[model samples]
Structures are given as structure tokens and as C-alpha cells.
Target: MAARVRRTTRHSSRFAAGSILIAAATFLPGAESAADAPGLEVPVDYTCRFPSGSHAMTAVITGSIPADGTAGRPVEPRDIALALELPAPAVAELAGLGAGSVSARADLTVVHTLGDETATANWSGLSASAQGITGQEQVTLHAEGSVPTATFGSAGTATLSASDLTLFLSPLQEDGSPTEPAAIEVECGLTDGSDGTLATVVVAEAEGEGEGEGAEAEPEKPVENGGTAEPEEAAPGAPRIEGRLPAGAREKLEAARQDVEALADGPDPCPFPPIPLPTPADTYVAGYTNVEKMDGAALLGPAHLNVTLMKEYIPDPCTSTFKVLSEAEFEYGGRRQLPPAQGTFLTYGFMPTTATMELIQVGGPAQIESVSVTSDPAMPEYTTVTAEFDLRIRDVEVNGVPLDVGAGCHTVKPIKQTLHAFGTGNPPSGYTVNRGGSMDGETYIPAFTGCGADEDVSSLLTSSISGGGNYIKITQAPLCVLNDTASVDCPAKKPTPER
Candidate 1:
């Protein structure tokens, strides 16, 4: 959330966790949300509290959404738009930090100086960034995708979850010198679930050698002040700049990754039925692509190969609308004639399903609000989309053991899915700023009675991906596989970040 600021006095001194300057702030609902507002309109108002009183904070969002995903059209490139300004005095003081830049290094080591004494800390392995702070009225900061001024456009609330968010500031350093990096970097986390939004404000010296001394910097948890100074109160739902994610985030993700993989390449073969892509009526993100590939399954002892692909159109912001281009590129080959069971598809190729996702960031963390199976009678492609699992199953004997998989062999229960399970963006893709999710429908085997839970077929799917700014980075990625098109490779594990 907020950086643990250590408030120091006008006279510089060795800095501790809680020995930095303090500022108080608050927010008041200035106006009601324009529920009837036809098109997307963003309104931001916040003030940073100082020692005396509150200052006015305001920002403006200007951009257009296109209509690329309207019908069955192609995607186009888009960019985020935002403008913000800090108080004039803060701007002036920051400007006074003579000749230095604001910087956040990959592995940063700094020697804090307050008059004479100093301490060192190593902020390494992790990355952070911030931008848009030059003594000016407003600065341009692009936030790849679009955000909702009102929740689902009806709740009459705001998510403020712009694909990329920037905080303007005139950061200062000791001795009135600018920090080395010179810019504020911005990074957001979809893995944070509802409140995944975080920022690391880098406003200190990049490298400092104690006066007339030479020594290495070591990591240490600077002690806090004896609860003397207090931070300013934040607006009702202001996004916090948490330096790092919560503990066990990696562990939870690893567990999800292992489980999904088993389900994908398990006995059930296909856990995620082919779901319909979103249409123009849906909320659209700038650049989106999802690929899930699996192999090895013996349904009736016939070897099969399956791959599912999902993609969203990219277009200029103004006219663009949310829409998905989906395909079930599953291939079931081999002439080994296997006995067919009831309710099982003879090459059932994608039994049919559809998905709807919402990206949100308000009242909580920035995250994928909801991902549910939906149906559209007007479009028969996704008639089977539902939160309840209905993955088509079959009745047969595996290894000479008879198993029950529903009458028609269709799965119907709670479909299991995991978001941010593999970290950053979707697993396999692991695209930074891009959110990822997967579904592994549970398999049911008759427990000598009726259909009982067996195991799940892991699914490699990305229900949603947001924020790439103007530049789009497609890893050794794949496109939707259609008829006559060959399927692309989807790694069983998350890919390393593209250097």
C-alpha cells in the first residue's frame, strides 16, 4: 500500500524505517457517479495531506475505445490515457533536489545520510518503477487497457484499476540532491486477486558512499520510530504501493500449477470444454491471447491430442469493444477402434462452453473480479457455458475396471479453476502485467455405486489479460488454431520473464 516512510526533520539525519518526513491525506466523495453516462468516462480526485491542511488532487483520463471485437473482426493496437499533477510546492522542492534523477535499480544498495550517521539496505532481486513527475500542470502516462469509471457500468462506482496507474510526485533525497534513477516506474499485479494493485516509490539515492569512507552496503530492517509520527489517511479506496506481494503467494501458485498440469494431461483429457469468446458487448482489454495444450489420454483406449486457444481483438481504444475469438483445436487421431460409451462424443471436439470475465480494482485490490461460464442462445457456440461443471464424460471400463461417468457421461458439478496460479500473467505465458487463469474440471468415477469424484483434467487457460502499455510483447506465443491450422505449443510450466 503506502511505502513505509521514515519522516526526518528539516535537518537531515540517518534514516530509519519510520524516520522519514510525514504527510497526511484524505478523500471526500466530491460527486455522484454518472450512472447514465453513456460512454466510458474516468474521473479521479484525491488530495495529499501535509502538516497543515489538505491539498487538492485531481487527474483526467482522455482516450477513446474502438469497436474491433464488435462482430467477428480482427484486433488492433490500443493505448491507455491519463494526466495527473502534484501540488506546486512539492514540485518546487523536488525540483530543488539538485542535478539528480529518481531511480529504482534491479538490485539497489544505498547509504542513508542524516547529518553524519548512515545505514545501508539492499533492495534486490525485485523490480519497481514510477513516472510522470516534472514541475508541470499535467503529464502524459499511458495505461495499456481501459478501466471502468463505474462498476460493470451499472454499480455507479469506479474501479480506478486503469491497466497501468501512475502517481505523480516530486521525490526528494538528502543534501537536496536528486535520486539517481530520475523516474518513477509503474507495475501492477493481477495475482493480488481483488487488490493486486501495488507500487514501489523509488525516491532515494541510488549509490552513496559515507563521507571520507569506503564500505559495502548490507541489508537490514531499519528499526521504526517509537510510534511517534503517523502517516496521512488515504482516500476511501486508494491503491497502495506495497513493495512486494504477500507471503506464500509463490507457494499457492506452485500448488495450483502442479494440480492444473495433472488435470490437463490426466485420464479425463479435456477438462475445459470449448467456451464461446466474449462479444463486442463485453469489456475488452487491449491485447489478449490464451493457449492450453495437452496430450496423453485413453478414453476407450484411443489415444488423443487436445489444444484450446482463446484470443481477444486488439484495436484503437475509442471505438474498440470487448470480444473474444475462441477455437477448440483439439485433435483426436489414430485408427485404434475403441468401444464408444454412452454420452461420449465420437470425436466430440470441444463439447461447448463460454466465458465472461471482469477486471476490477476498487474497495479492494486490483484483480479479475469474476470469471464464470455463460451461454448465448443467439450464438450456439457457447450454449454449455455454466459455473456448474458439465464437462462431457463417458461410461467405460479403464484397465478392465468399470466406471460410471454420468448417464450421458457429461460432467455436472463444481468446475475447478485457478487464477494467477502460475504467477504474473497466465501460466505458460506468464506475461507480466497480463493476468492468467486455468480450469481443471473434476473427473467422476463410479465408486461401485454412481459417478464419484476421481481426479481433474488440468486446463491451461487465461480468462483475462490486461495492461501492456503501447508496446506488446508476444512470447514464443501461439495464435488461435482454426480448421486446417496447426496447433501451437503451450508449455506445461510457466515461462521465465522475457529479458
Candidate 2:
């Protein structure tokens, strides 16, 4: 037997009491009929307006649904679909912003379903399109969703009403700006007809003058004293350098050059060094580590160099990329600071989701037109980090070999390296960069180092470290190029005066 339903409240009385009092009728079983069983309904004849020359729009829908418990089936799913017609084909432009196709008959589906028994609605599948219209764009919207099947025991007349529905259209630009549309309309209805009511709300276009002025005026270009003029050329002998180096060592140098270029440009590149190297206790920055130890020896090998190389060679970090940036901090003297040292290092376990590169132009002893680098967030077992830097070559030499240079044209010589020292202690095996107070028989320093490069410059004044170890302090000396007669000092730092 279809359950014996009875209406506890009279629809006439409820309607007389006012729309807000409808909730009191939920308990009344046969009081309302299926057609009149207050279900989803859209406001009668609605309309939305868009200002002239704008892409934004405001829509208002009015209607009502049966109060909680009033109908046989209390729950219902509803949605609103919108379709925009444009005079001309504009789908390509609108699609770029995730809008529907631009054709004479474009349809935009904007769905909304009620949450809980409260009749509260939420917008879903909301999208726009530009396809067919005579001269401008016209937006059309309608409500849709499932309806209740059970009917109210033939007592109160089936009620069909809706609450107010409003919609605002905006663009998803980086700046979060919205463009006003030329026109807008809204409609509402129910998808199912089981027990609930279906209502239709249609908004007609306003006939009067549209809101706002159409489109923004074009800005006038500034005129020079006589007419548009070109920029002056760089002064002669300005050390305008531009060039490219050979593939091998030149790659590493080029990577370093790109880092310098980033610093020279506005946005700050990673403040941390390209590769984390070990540092002496007296100058050690906190939180950074160059080594990890296992048992009494280096965790990976004699110098921890093997482990660092293995980790660095891994293509991906095993952990989430987001966490790697924060982990770069190192602890020193109970406080955190940037490590003070430079050299190749490797870190294990890293993962990155996105990589971005920006081209920059810097004028100095040499003018650089572009710089690029790749960064991945640190991950576990995947913590390796690889960075490459490129510079516009005015002049460059790798191992005393000269390179080619030109404008708009440049060469890339990368400085490839890795970082691995992440734990707290003298790496079990290699040397220690910073030796903290000894603990038991093991030394606890917060850093480690690894040596890597095609050429072994370890014998030269340029020191090459192979594995973990205690932080070593080396005096900062001017770098000089070797000539047959004598050694000439190479400029290590760019002078501020020129900058």
C-alpha cells in the first residue's frame, strides 16, 4: 500500500500566513498534492543586466520550494544552465578563459543542487560560451534537476514556487578582474517529477539604454619632442660582452652565470646557494647540512661523495615538492641563518610539481639578455636538486678556451652539481664542514660537502672535496688566470659603481 498520507496544515492558511511560514506545513501529509507539493520553482519572469562595454553580469531569480518535510520526498537535486548567443563567432576568445564555444547556438551549462533538506542551493558546472547572436552577446540561464515523484494526498493544491536566485559572472584572470556583459537572462525548473513541483523562471532583456559606456577608450601614445625615437646605444668600450661556450665545462660556468643574472635582475632567485657545501664552524650558517652518517662511517661511502652522486643523479625527489623550500634552512648557534660557503653538493629525496623560467637583461662589464634555471621542491629519496644558468656571451673562456659572442644570441655552459648533507652530525664517513662539540665518540656538525665535476681541480688552489667531513675554512683569495710570464688577478665581484 502507498503509505496513508495526511495533510496536517492547509495550503490556503500557509499561503495567507506568508511565504516564510511554509516550513510549518511539512508535517501535514495529504494537505498538498504532487502538483502543488511545494517543490523547486523559479521566480516568475526575471531579468539580468550587463553594463555596456563590460563582461560582468548580475542575474536575479525568484521562486520557492516546499518547506522541509512538507512533501513526500524531502530531497531534490537542482541546477541552472546558461547559454550565451553572440552575433559573431567569438568561441576562440571566450574558450581561452574556459568559456563555452562561440557559435550562433552556444550553450553554457551552469548546474546547481540543493544541499541538505534546507532547500539551500549551490552553483556547479557553471560555465559560459559565446556562439550565436544577431549583433552582441546574450546570456540565457535555466534551473534544472531531479523532482520528487510522490504526490500530496488530494487535499491542498499542488504548490509550485521558488526562492530568489542570483548569479554573478566574472573572469578568472590572474588579477581577478571581471568584464561586464551586454545582456543576461535566468530560468529555473526541476529535472524529476516524482513528488516535487517544477517551476520556471525566465528573465527578459531590459529595453532601455544599457548600463555603463561601451568599452574602454584606447590610450593615446606619448609623442617625443619631434616623433617616436629609438633608445641610445650603449657607450663605446662598455665591456658589452655576449657569447657562447663549448658544451663541456662551459655548461657549468654558464649555469653559474645565469645565477648571477638572476641576482642582477629584479625578482630574487633562490637565496640559498646553488649547491649546499660544508662550512667551518666559525662561519657556519645554521640549519644547513652537507652530510649524513651511518654507524661510525659516512652513510654512503668513504667521503659520502658516492652517496651524494647517487642521490644527485636520481631524476626525481621521492617526497612532496612543496616542503623542500622550507627545509633549506639550517640551524646554527641555536638560530637559523643562510650557510656561508660555495661548492658542489647533493641532497637526497625531492619532488617538484612546477618549474618556471624568466628571461632577464643585465648591463655591466657584460650585457646579458636572458637567464634560465630549473628548480624542484625537495623530496625524500628524491631530494636531488639540479640548476642551470645561461648568460649572453660577450666573451667567455672555458679552461682558457675562448667562446663565440653576439646580440640576441647567447651560449649556455652549465655548472652541474648536487646537495645531500641534510642530517645533523659529521657525516659517518667523510670530512666534516663544521665540527660542533663532540658527542660520545661522534662529532656533531650541521654540514657536509661533496666534490663533483668532469675535471679534478682538487690539486689546484681550487679545492675539490670528495665526501663528507669537518667544515674547513679557506681564506678568500682573489682568483687569477695563469699566463706564461705571471698570474693576472681575475675580477671576482662586479663593482657597485658600474651597476
Candidate 3:
């Protein structure tokens, strides 16, 4: 049997760079950015485990991908390849085993980041042709193949970085027969503290969309009344809407929308076929609700939410709603994984069954808009939050009979709600953003649309479930500090309805 053992150490091993090498690149000052250059050149260090021992290898990856692409369009990278230089010691050992030639196949993982949203994809099926091995001279393996394409859903600057490379080596005799060891699998990880950036691309809005028409409009000066000033007329050359957006609010709104959308994806983690346990989060914010319908049936939920705090841009001028703070300057973005809720309720006093509802946030994350602090005992200290969402009734069952609601069954308009929280203990029972507490709001459910897959059931649902005066009671749990074990419950508990 072949002696089986593995060892690892840091060593200055070199790699023959190629278009698709598994490595990070070095960028020189004054050089063209990846967007302007013909291709990217990056150097990466990796630690690989072999039967004899572990070796550290440095490699340079060179490849070409379009510097700019339209949102919702796929961008393909070209001339992707990999080159590896095996140390002479490892080559000699392979030759000693009666193997005359060797070949390899590799796969790599790539990460794409747009704002705070991140997605990972794999680049697989690259191969290096077999080459003869002799004496103690170093051996070189070259690999190249088709790579996956990346598609961005929104407009922004997206960065693509590479990590985690796996290689499969096959040893064979001169006649191409497998050697005694057959094949070897080597797992390699980027060296600690090494960057594996592949490329950065700028994504623009799709065709026929007017996204940057009035880029020069500045926000109106703050007013003494604390309300937003009436918007002035647009400059002669700018597109005229009802009003112009603040100087940079358009850009901020785009980014905020992308960030909120990232968090709003996927099913709710609180119910049915339990989800994986939560990971340690540095911060946590949740919304638990018991929403009562017009007919008294209720929906219970705790939509777990997280946000990226301390962002520097305000995202309101693009909205039709009036601004609360005449001089609001910053905004925070929520993280992805917004939960879709599932619950069962009694309909019309007798029918009992389950329903799957998707709460789609209409615009973006809740906006704080403004905050006020006061030393005078009578002048209250408070902050207001505004958010809008469409309650989509996707699946329903009455008396265990599945209602054929079409995919688009949802409220005709988004349900707009405003919430308030006291920063100080003014009410002693009110919510504080940082500490979490109770919040209540009322929603007007408009008629449902696009209901009924086989037969039109839109009227049936609208008449029985839709109306004004739907009450929503929510309780937010304290922020979970992921790093502080004492302060957080990893994978937060399912929220309990407040009232």
C-alpha cells in the first residue's frame, strides 16, 4: 500500500501564472482599473495538502470580463485559465511511484458583492493535460475551460472575487493505465490575509430607463417648521417630475433598494419544516406581529430583520411621500433573508385551514426620517419609522380545501404604516429602536387582484378578507449581539405577538 501521510507548512512556492489561475492580482498605481483594462492580473497564495506534506504556492490569475454591463444582463468572462508550478520534490515523489505522467482538474469558488448583498458561484471543469515526469525538474500544469456567467439584478458597482480552489490529480503509466495510487485529491485554501479579487464591473440601469436625468439637483434648504420645503421647479434641461430629487438621493435610493431586496428574499425562518439554527450575528432586530383582518381572522408572525448600521446617505427625495426631516443626512440598510410567513386561521367563523402569505416591502427598508431629543420634561423625545409593504396572499385553504389563488394575488396598493418609538422612558412602555419594544399600526387592505388560477376567486377573497381597520400589533426583541455570547440568542427565537 502507498504510504499515506499529510504535512503542511508555509513555504515560498511559485506558480506559472495564466489567464484563469487561482490567485489574486497586483494593481499598480496609474494603471487602468479593471473596468478600463483589457484583462485583470492578480496574484494569490494557496496552501495545499499532499500525501508527503503541505506546500504553499503563489499564483497569478489573468482573465478578461466586460468592465460594464446592463442590469439584468449576463456578463461572460473570456480567456479564463490556470497555471501551476509543482515543486521538484513533489514531482520526484510522484515519479518514484512508477507513474510516468500526471493530469489535473480544478474547481474554484467566486463571490459577487453588490452593496451589502453577496452571492457565491462555482467555476468548475478546468483541466490540465497529462505531461511526462522525469528526474527532479519542476513540472508545470496548464488548465483552461468555460466559466460561468454573472448576472446582476440591479444597477451598481459589483465586485467579483475568487476563493477556495480544489484540484484532482490523476497519475498514470506510459500506456495510460492507472498507477497504484490511482488519483489524488488536493484541497487548497487561500493563504491567510491574502486577497483573491478577480474583477470589478460597473452595472448600469437597463435600456429605456431614465435613472440619472437630474443628477445636479440639490436638496432644498431646511425649513424652521421641521417639514420638508416644497420642491422648486427643475432646471430647464432636467426631466420634470412632480419635483426634483435631492442632490444625491437618487443614487442612495437605488443602493438602498438593492440592499433591502437582498434581505427580503427567501421564506420565513420561524415556521414549518424548521430552518437551520441561526449563526452568531453582531446585531439583530425583529418584528413580531398579530395582524387582525376585517372579519377577525388574524395572521401571526415575527419577520426577522437585520440592518447595516451607520450608512452615510439619506434615501427619501425619490419617494412621493413627504419627508419628515428637512435636513435628514444619513440612512441605514437592512440585511437580506426577509422571511415569508405561513400560518393557519379561521375564515368566516367556521372554515379552518392554513395560508401562505408573502409580505413584500413596497419600496425599501423602514426610514427613520428624523429624531428629536429634549431636556424640557414636557417636550417629548421621539423618532418615527415609516415603511410600506404589500400583503400577497399566495396560497390559501378554506376548510382544508386549497383555494386556487393565482401567483399575483396581492393588495391593489401597498399598506403604508407609520410607527413611533420613544428614545427616553417617556411612556415607559413604548419602543426604543436600540432596546426594542411594542409597536402598533393600522392597515387598510384593498381589494385583491390576480386571484384564482382556474376560476376567478379574487372576488371571494376580497369580499371576505379585504377592508379597512386591520390592526397590527408588533413586538421587537432586543438586538442580538452575535459576538457577545451573553447578549444574544444565536438564531433568534420566533417572536411572540404583542397583543
Q: How do all models score by TM-score?
A: 0.23, 0.19, 0.36
- Model 3: lDDT to the true structure: 0.54
Candidate 3, residues 160-206: lDDT per residue as tens digits? 88788877777777776667776677788999998988888887876
**Model 2 deviation from the true structure expressed as Cα RMSD, one decimal place:** 30.7
Per-residue lDDT of candidate 1, residues 1-499 (tens digit): 1111222221111222221211110111221222322233454554444323445544344443231111111111122244444455544444555422222212222222222222222222221223334545433323222221110101111112222222322233533333543333322212223331111111222133222232222222334553222123322222111111212334544554454356446554422333454321111112212211111122111112122323333221221112233222111233211123122211123332222212111121112222111221111111011122223433343334554434433322322222232222210111122232221222222112223346322121211111111111112112222342222111111112111
| Poorest stretch of ten by lDDT in candidate 2 | 301-310
Range of the 10 consecutive residues with the lowest summed lDDT in candidate 3:
10-19
- Point out where model 1 deviates above 4 Å: 1-44, 50-53, 63-80, 99-256, 259-421, 424-499
Order of candidate numbers by lDDT, starting with the best: 3, 1, 2
**Candidate 2 per-residue C-alpha lDDT over 1-499 given as tens digits, one digit per residue, 9 for 90 to 100:** 1111121111111111011111211122333323333433332322222222223222333223333223122222223333323212232334344444221111222221221111112222233322222233443533322222112111122333333333323322232222233113333232223222244222111234243312222222233332221112322111011101111222333444554445557443333223332221111111112222211111110010001111111111221111122112223234332212222222121211111111121221111011112241111111222223221212322234432322332223322223222111111111112111111111123211111234322222112112334221111112222221122112111110000
Off by over 4 Å in 3: 1-37, 210-499
Better of 1 and 3 by lDDT: 3
Q: Cα lDDT for residue 50, model 2?
A: 25
Top lDDT model: 3
